[model samples]
Target: MNSANGSAWDDWDDEVDLLVFGAGAAGMTAALIAHHEGLNVLVCEKTAAVGGITSTSGGTTWVPGTQLSVDAGVPDSVDDARRFLQSVVGARGGDAAREAFLQSGPLAIDELQRISDVKFVAAAAHPDYVTGPGAAFGGRALAPLPFDARVLGKDFARVRPPRKEFMGLGGMMVNRNDLGALLSPFASVGNLKRTLEVVGRYCVDRLSYPRGTQLVMGNALAARLYYSLRKRDVPVRFDAPLVELIREQGRVTGAVAGSADGSRRRIRARLGVVLATGGLTRHPVLRKQLFPVAAQPLSLSPDTHTGDGIASALAAAARLEDGGDSPGLWMPCSIRRAPDGNDHVWPHIILDRAKPGLIAVNSRGERFVNESNSYHDFVMGMLRDAGDGQSVPAHLIVDAAFIRDYGLGLLMPGRSRARIAEFERSGYLVKGDTLEQLASKLGVDAAGLARTVQAYNRDAAAGKDPAFNRGASPMSRFNGDPAQKPNPCIRPLGDGPYYAVTVWPADLACSAGLSGTANGEVLDANGAVIPGLFACGNDLASIFRGTYPGPGTTLGPAIVFGWRIAKFVAGKLDQAPAGERSRATACANQPS
Candidate 1:
């Protein structure tokens, strides 16, 4: 089966319906839908592994204005969700993208559940970014399947753990309150017991399941699809990156790829190619190109997301549409040095909303924007010039009392206290006994820092935070402890030995990508579709422009469009005239 040149002739034939480029969440989701729709599907992954960023992400897919809200007895309409998206995304997003997402999201979720191993839980407390005017309060985000990893067996080694694992507890069934309770030590006994039970059951599943069958979120989706395809003896060769798209007469006929052994082999796809390889997060060149000054050595995605699939598709004459432009971008991340001397990057920390008494500042020692705003707003403020047309790196300032009373954003209370203490001793965290002393140590202006704190404290004590308006929406529930009546997220700066950590606006990835239609069709620079090509996930222009409308926004649209592209292609194949016998045969094998 495998040639000495390292190329395996995998039943190569010109009679397949779908060719999926990446096995990430979106691609895998599409594969399941297409396969169940009676299409012959072939998925190729560049890495030795299958799951992409979804495996390493928080694993929560944010889909706003979904029917799940309706089924749950919450009143959320597609029309209302569309209005909110327009407000957040502005004119960049129009009727096409909005309509596509709303129309397909519920079906996507439902279909995945019926055919795959998905166990979704509605977000009980995570509100749409736009909550006040025509926004759902707590029904947009969907958690991943709560699966037992034992199902994966040997395959488990290939799956990447979520970069932020603490957030993935509660079997993908967690409500916002469940998540908050998980974060809080004083109020987590019940949640803790339940979490232990879930872990116990997961351990059992791993022990009893087949070596290649696992039930974790990304692994669950991947395993279920893998099992289905494997049942039919479909071949999956890993470490096989798409080298080129084989073309004939301006249509994609097949592809050539490089396998793990460094040999190239050609495979034919009679129908079409689906590129769901995800974004270029791990591609430093792309990162620096998109965000010149945000930070270096940055990436929230796993090292596997090198944008190879995107590049290969472009080379095959697939034009990428311009995606959401960068604005109000916020990384809101945590940084700690790895043992290898490189920094461990963590992005999109929602804890800023739960903890109130803290504020973020640039290197110039001044508040730049609302620390509690959406991640988009938070990062954009950091990217702004700190007056006088000079650039300023940012740092986060938190009081000792604040940390003790309310907790640091991601560093849970019990563990965070010790970690902060260690960081202080190690010089990563700066602390001093007095306001002026702390400012002096951190190389910031003592008088200005003190004045800022004084004004903030004065306003907070009066039950009014005019500077930033910390608590503005339901999303800010974790701003601070409810026990602190006045300014729950705000506290006076006098409790000496203050603290500061050099912070940067970390990004999940560049959300700005090639623009695409709702059906995941990439258009030319002139806005004309180049038939036989499609895109989804970060590789496609975001339907909500750049701003995250809610928790599952990225995953929601990616899966929807992936399905949409397959459905569209299938429909076309089914309608082809009978005279075109050879073409019809190819189309028949692809899927409909």
Candidate 2:
């Protein structure tokens, strides 16, 4: 009954009740659930590090109707969430898949919190990215509560580090709340105390470690999952990539994986295989087919996500979802090459664009969108304004006052002089004594720049943006500094020393992938289930059908479906023969 590359069953290296691929949040969650169900399980990671892009992400999950939201006094229900999804997703995604995600999301969170070390808190102040029907001011998005990486002990080294550009003070990881204290240490006694405590801890950590051990966001989520796995005694093989899936009687039964040194091992899974690889954003051919704009050199996803899961599933007759409005979730990112000859990307998620005194302009120096919009919408504006690639590299213009309070791109706030000098030296930022000079340096039209700034300043002074309405939305105000007068998202670009940073369209996640059933079974071209094969995370086609509904949309569904697939596999394992169960358990106890 063995299939795939003609690998003989006699050469099988190991066996387990379930095999999970890609060791990100989704994969790890699946493994944890399988172990909880008393099934023998194994996890395979394609890269040296287990946390895929999730480790470097914001680590927020948009799971509505959760206990955390209720405990935080935020009103949310399944009906309201369904309405929200209907308004945003329309009819693109199947009703079954969407309904399953909505129903399973809160349950997944509740179960994980009850059974594992995972903890979540409601983001009460965060608003949905778009102000549409059924959108809530809060309660929909949940973020992982900050976790202490020291809990992992020496295993902390296995956790992937956050992007260098995202950290501060030589790799000290700061959360959103701590960032405010760090930015304004003199604001109050409480602020000063918080700053001292954080800095003191960071200084102590740096004495021995390359980066601070206080994990936040994606790293915190990954660390918690890894900790849970270790506690459950789950065996995870790093640098092991799936090469082929073995089919028995038209059902997936096992897989062959290759090590970094080209050594191969066959693993027999008695129940099923779960594909949770991040997604297809880094695949060259797939990118060409999926992306609307010219292929750019930047992607926010980890390099390990190259459609491995999608390719493997499709090869086994799995179907791919079609009719997504956009094939990817995008972010506006800036690139800077370091002395090490590598290009570093900084995603402008919430730092600069919405703040006062900053404007984004196309090549002609004309504003095309509300600059205070979400990162996803900002890139959509760029794509729309990109006529023949003219706006491919849009410029974000900010004045010296803005840079001092809220740094542009990789330049941190408050320390403008030294950081700006370093940025200019690296050619990552352009500076000018006047708007005209800045336009000249950026290759934008001088007259257009002057006219645009003049009109914007007049609007800022009047506290009204008649052109784009930058400060009109709740989402915009959430990301803005409320201490400023009239409008938080609008201010006049006063005198001189204007700065410009080049921004490119970068994908944050693949919005389209292998089509699967609600329980995670891969679907064939005719919509029949490909038995024993399942997918979650970016490996599964997005439930939103390409719309960025809110923060954590990518992660929420990933966790829900991973949980669902584990439950489904557990049911199948319960029905298997005693000999099969014993053999799987025997293999699981064997040393890797």
Candidate 3:
């Protein structure tokens, strides 16, 4: 099945030393690093454009012990990162993988910066997700390349702008504080000035040289990597999606890719194939298999991440190993369909507990989970709710204050407000002139909700969150109103004209896939390695197991693993002993 085994390149064929399957952040980073190492590289993207969800995401890369932290005057240590990872992953965290990630992260950043015109700024305020036990308050997360999109020449037109719900350009990195500033209303002159400053910077970038500078975190990252690869004359093909991987004796040799224009091409890799084609949240069958929840779809990840690469690896693995227990999933997230028909996902429990006037309740109209806890815990509560036959449609309760303060329901200025009212009238949003009335409207016992609110206020007044033990981390502060003394996020919802937006538990892209060692070597279910095949990003099981350790942890691991794969292919790690080989009985044996 290995189409890449022989030199099938005819006169019209182009050849390169490396072939990268995705041009998103992870693939782009890997391609840039390899290209910087003086290796010829080719990046083929399924999308007509490069920069996958990374362009749409808050472009932050979390890495411990980096120059960004040191230079920014924030302090962090490797020990802190290790302790945090261990606490989050328990015994499942591997020392080699952790070490590889930490050690290679900064080096990867530096190497890429040296070869490309990329710039990075530190997100000093972006604290570790949990600063309580073994986590640091600073220096772990780094922002995306601080780029002025004016440099991309004609490539700028292809960039996606940052969604207004969050601040920062495609490449401009910001943390919770920045997010707060964006979400906050024009209540202060300082905020207005800050907003103007950001806008002015973009205006300047637009007027300076380029006619259309599509500047954002994603575009900036893409431009830097794409330009760097192009500078080395690396071949890039767009709308080309890999269909299958060819293997010989348990080693992948090449891939068969079909282009959007109905052209098929065979690309053979001499070194190896990197499977970064993303996870299966976008695949309906995979979503049903993985989530098993009826009628609910995930919304956090792009629609393109359907675990195609993972499926391919699983197929190859089935031929290599038998009865492999698919890795467990880290199930979190709450999603509502966007007005544009896409899922609008946020760490719901986190956002509600962090932001005021938002609380999640089960169909019985009672609060079930710790509203202020991490996303994983919140999703677990929803899962439990689903099992109980209780329509755990999470209801986001807010008022005019919330609407005036922050953009609601993913609708921004110039966007239609019809969806918000539609959901409300359709019973998805419960609104009333009083708290009890709103609760009554939503099918919850009015007294129960009222009691819950009273209890929450008492906790807020005491500056203590006894229910969820929130306020322990800085992340929750963004959810509260600073003017509210004691507990900022714990205000009572007894105000007049209360509103409730039903929140539904939605999936983010699946965080589980082909099991691989820390070295990124694709391993069978029996812990055996498949030579010349590697996977990273959403294509492999996350190092954090089922929990998101912090922001940028995903991208951090991607960069490290991508770098590790490149180096391993170049024979840089002699310590990486090839493991035993085993095949799967069928690709279907792997997890959904």
Best-performing candidate as measured by TM-score: 2
* Candidate 2 structure lDDT: 0.84
Each model's lDDT comes to: 0.62, 0.84, 0.62
Q: Pick the candidate with the highest lDDT.
A: 2
TM-score of 3: 0.83
> What lDDT, from 0 to 1, does candidate 1 have?
0.62
Q: RMSD of model 2, in Å?
A: 4.6
Using lDDT as the measure, name the better of candidate 1 and candidate 2. Answer: 2
lDDT string for model 3 (1-592, tens) is 6434334433224445567888776787777766666666777788766666666565667888777788889867777777777777677645566667876777777666666666677766766665546676667877765565555566665554443334444334344444445545375888777766665665566555433253445556666666666667767688788788877556676677878879777766666678777666576665666564632454556667776787778778622211012222323443455466654444433334466555566656667775655554566566666775574656656665665444344432222357556655544445688877887777777777777777776776677767776555676664456776666666555466766665555544345566776667788767677766777777766666666677666777877778776766554544443341123212212221
The estimated TM-scores of all candidates read 0.84, 0.93, 0.83
Query: Please, what's the RMSD in Å of model 3?
Result: 6.0
TM-score of 1: 0.84
lDDT per residue as tens, model 1, 494-559:
577677766556556556566556666665566655455667877776666666776656777777
